[model samples]
Target: MSISNTTNFTNPSDFILLGIPGLETAHVWISIPFCAMYAIALLGNSAILFIVKKEPSLHEPMYYFLCMLAVTDLVLSTSVVPKALSIFWFNSRQIDFSACLTQMFFLHCFSVVEYGIFVAMAFDRYVAICHPLRHSTVLTNLVVAKIGLAVMLRSGVLVLPCVLLAQQWPYCRTNVIPHSYCEHMAVVNLACADTRASSYYGLSLIILVTAMDMVLIAVSYTQILRVIYSLPTKDARLKTFETCGSHIAVILIFYIPALFSFFTHRFGRNVPLHIHILMANVNLLVPPMLNPIIYGVRTRQIRDRLLRLITHRDT
Candidate 1:
């Protein structure tokens, strides 16, 4: 194969990213808010993780999943937000090919893991609500550990090949990505060679993974609702619904924006760049920021524990 056709960047003259238009003029303004967001996301998620770890009452499977979710959020935000803030602040938009690929890998990996965690959390709720008699058997400590491992393994293995395939594509001329983070589609679009295979593979994977998880979660919640309705006491039904209300809100917040962004990017090319960028960042940032808040507020036990911890620390 010709040197030009090869994916390997043997020389520095490989790819040039045409960064977002008008970045020089808008960098400073965007930087301020972006930096603030990063600070809040890091501090917020870290605080949740610390609270969950230090509190013995939070040793249950639900809180265990929340801890995992917090960790994933921290990883996700740490991977993308700092780089984004740097670009906004210093106008240093250049990212090495290997570094870009690594970013894409981790971003996708953690995103997949986050989806898996949502599924697991949904299952936890289902078991607790629908099968209270067997909740312990269904979601034991060992089972939670195994599920966590499966989430990591499933996402890691499934996304690794896609990242490798992406890195194999020759990026000849354009390397600039529009958004702050290394989105897979955006990165693939930079390749000089045909990216039809990579695009199709990615779409297939997204559809398969996301659709399956959504179906499972939906089914789990359906059974949970059924069980809730079967309860003879109105208070019992109301309490059960209250327990799941926050999670359902979180599910909508997390999935709706992501699905919109993904579909618009894939099929709705006519959408404006600013709109796309806005939706993409919202998908990444909002969920991380909202998740901990939702759990802390909706679950009285967690809220009470968080309050106690704060009060104790202050004392």
Candidate 2:
């Protein structure tokens, strides 16, 4: 059956994404790879969390931030992957308005929190590398807990209004979302009502929250670089830079495509839908999938622990 027939949406469900065209043609073929990726994301992120929680030696502010990142990755993958798989495999792409809104809300919420956590991680790295003697005192357990709470609250405050505003609009067209998941702009674009205000508000939030967080992260890393440069020994400088390399790589991986996707969707729709879809998937999936591997390989403790766990499990 056609999407319109299945959805029976007359009023234009503001949030029901129909997924991109051409997916229906390759549904069966795509399902295998998509499901495999989702399985890996779920299992991989969950294992990260389990390892961090079970290992007492990892009970520190740095690992705490890593745990938070793992949780965010799991939530992000969970929020988008299953529904996407269902759409591809079962030919059940019709998401209700409320469900779509809920998905969009959680997606944005976790995305914002992910950025906040990245900033926090940068700060942690800065302290550890630049002020090693004072790192413990500066980033105590209490302080880390407060920071995590603050990140959640900040994300909620920034994204809640945007989701509410987008939902209030009247959808006047087909409810089929052209992508696999319910993204904020995709939903807003479907509205028959004037979306200028909502668009502006969402853009403003993106600029304020994302831009500011990136600035703070940049400043922290700058200071870190200066300290690393001033070290007397080349080995000390190399070790310090090594500690931050994975974080820098992850940051670029996470932000560049996201910003590009956002801009392309908003300003470059003239670009092919396929390009947009590709970029969007990269922004959503690649970072989460790579984060664990990057951190696991770079951080000796996590690497050793992961190895030990795997070895013990195999034995």
Best lDDT goes to which candidate?
2
**What TM value does model 1 have?**
0.92
Q: Would you estimate the TM-scores of all the predictions?
A: 0.92, 0.93
Please count the clashing residue pairs in each candidate, in the order shown: 4, 6
Q: Which segments of model 2 are wrong by more than 4 Å?
A: 5-16
Please give, for residues 1-315, the per-residue lDDT of candidate 1 as tens digits.
112333444223423332344454776786676667767777778877888788887889998998899899888878887777776666566777788878889998999999999999999999898778998888999999999999999999999988988877776654456677778998887777788999998999989999999999999999998989999999989988998888788889888998899999999879887678767876788888888888888888878987987898999
Which pairs in model 1 have colliding backbones? 16-175, 17-175, 17-176, 18-176
lDDT computed for candidate 2 = 0.83
